[model samples]
Target: MGGLLLNCDIGESYGAWTMGLDAEVMPYIDCANIACGFHAGDPSVMRKTVALAVAHDVTIGAHPAYPDLVGFGRRSMVCSAQEIQDLLHYQIGALDGVCRAQGAKVSYVKPHGALYNDMMANPAQLRAVVEAIARYNPQMPLMLLAMRDNAAAQAIADEFGVTLWFEAFADRAYDALGRLVSRNLPGAVHHDPETIISQALTLSRGEALIASDGSELLLAAQTLCVHGDNASSIAAVQRIRQALGKTSAS
Candidate 1:
């Protein structure tokens, strides 16, 4: 009953290539951010993932990314605000269609990879993304990385009249500013299940996290993200769920 929503990026496998043990991870998560076609998943994958989520009774969310399948949507590209907005709408609509066919509804929209990072700091891009979500389904909430005491994103969401879910990364390192450490750097990821569990517990308890510089930073989040691509990520999520259960009961 505590206010913590566990979410995972899923449906990333493309064609014959596969990524993430999504089937193993789904049961442990409350929300599944299924990849739209732009990022990594195809139509077939989307349909299957939607069905899996429906069967598991997990909340579904659209995982839209820049049209860079070659980069796995991790690489940023030069795109006009209009182009970005259009692509986002298209991606969300596609997922919505699939979810409807499966008798499931997308409950939220979360930008993926480079688009996610870029929109967090860029007002123009953020506006574009917000606008896109508003156009498609204003009631559908947006899930984005939490910014410490920053009201810009919140204000935009308010203007759009859409709920926002501030998200925190449980398996990633953070800087003193409470921003995620660049993936380009070493030690950006927590591969140890113990460390991941501890971090998730700390965040769940509304405690501060120690940044790389040994400074305490506060993160206010409604949802915690566990990357599906990491090896041993399923075990990490299971540990987190167990820890949350223990904390809740204590």
Candidate 2:
């Protein structure tokens, strides 16, 4: 709470399939954007992740996605606003139930994968998401990508009386428009620890980033999104935590 909060997508293990070093990374992250059933997590996984988060005092956030288990919710699907709203309600409710059993509750909402991209690129999808959050719990903040110009998204959230938490990636390259560079493209993700930590520090200081198109992009973000899927990613998160701590303390 003292500085830019760190969040990670976690609890993505399915039956007989495991993903992410949840326990190893939970201690370093401030928020957990746990996967709901539609994406990767099952009931058991959700409950376990919620308990772990509660134990670590990390905030739980519902990571809802399009009903695409095969694609890990990264494939876009055709869905109306109403359908999207329904999906949001169903996923959030399921995760909230799991959290309740563990004496914890989801503190925020963050769409996953393709849904996240669609919402940022489509105003209609964004409005539907905002509306869903407002109706579900106006107090709950919706976490979305922070861009060079957040005014449009902010206006939509303002209309619904919903709080928005602009998020930035510390390890991903951004396009000139401030959207993340496509993962399919080369150099979309930063692999070097120095580059990742440097980007984190720059964002924490509200400094400009060199976009893929060589433009200076400033993202006004309230939180930083980090990954912890494997040993290397976990190590990066640790380095980010340490680097940010030094920056905050100074």
Candidate 3:
């Protein structure tokens, strides 16, 4: 339980349009997945978020996507493997530069939205992502979803010599196969604090979690994610830390 790193997506604000309670949520999380300009952040926002993460002593991670700013990087793009690698390298470097300027470095990489989903499902795209990360910096860990069946990508990650950090979501539902339930599905995103906290506890202890169709999956987690952009979810983050602290003590 103590080993699980609590992570949240932040720095989503682009230009004057702000997104996420970055400052309010920073204190509670161990890692900050900062948007790297492709999705929701600008250069200035990235700088500010990097400073915030540094101030809070949180791990900084680059959250890169398919350069879909209008769709907030949730829309998939058709691109070659080489193109994907280039965009990823560019995003990671942009964030890493900001981190370096602020005396904090990007410690990891995590694909955002559609790119994340695609990579998780397609071996070719997943290989491209792994290659990008390893080429950018092999020392930086790659954060990935920990599902019931994850061996294929794990093997690929090993082949590329990239470390994988498996994460389970605290407020999202998973399918019977241990994949995250689609956002389009009813009740895919949970809002109940108790339910979210319970799952967080289950995952931290490496226990079985009930899937959307009432199946069970045992997901191992080195880190856990909670969307901290909303006020309610931010509050859940505080409670989760408190609950995990209690469990650690017990």
Ranking by lDDT: 2, 3, 1
Q: Give stretches of model 1 more than 4 Å off.
A: 246-250
lDDT of 2: 0.93
What RMSD, rounded to one decimal, does every model reach? 2.5, 2.2, 2.4
Error of 1 at 170 (Å): 0.9
lDDT per residue, candidate 3, 98-126, as tens digits?
98887889999989999999999889999
Tens-digit per-residue lDDT, 125-226, candidate 1: 998899888888898899998866658889988988888899999989998877789999999988887888899999999999999899888999988998
Q: Find the 10 residues in a row with the least total lDDT in model 3.
A: 241-250
For TM-score, candidate 1 versus 3, the one ahead is 3
TM-score for candidate 3: 0.96
Q: Clash number for every model? A: 0, 0, 0
TM-score quality measure for candidate 2 = 0.97
Q: What is the lDDT of residue 9 in candidate 3?
A: 88
Q: Top TM-score: which candidate number? A: 2
Indicate whether candidate 2 or candidate 3 has the larger TM-score.
Answer: 2
Query: What is the RMSD of candidate 1?
Result: 2.5
lDDT of 3 at 156: 97
lDDT of 1: 0.87
Name the 10 consecutive residues with the lowest summed lDDT in model 2: 241-250
Best by lDDT: 2
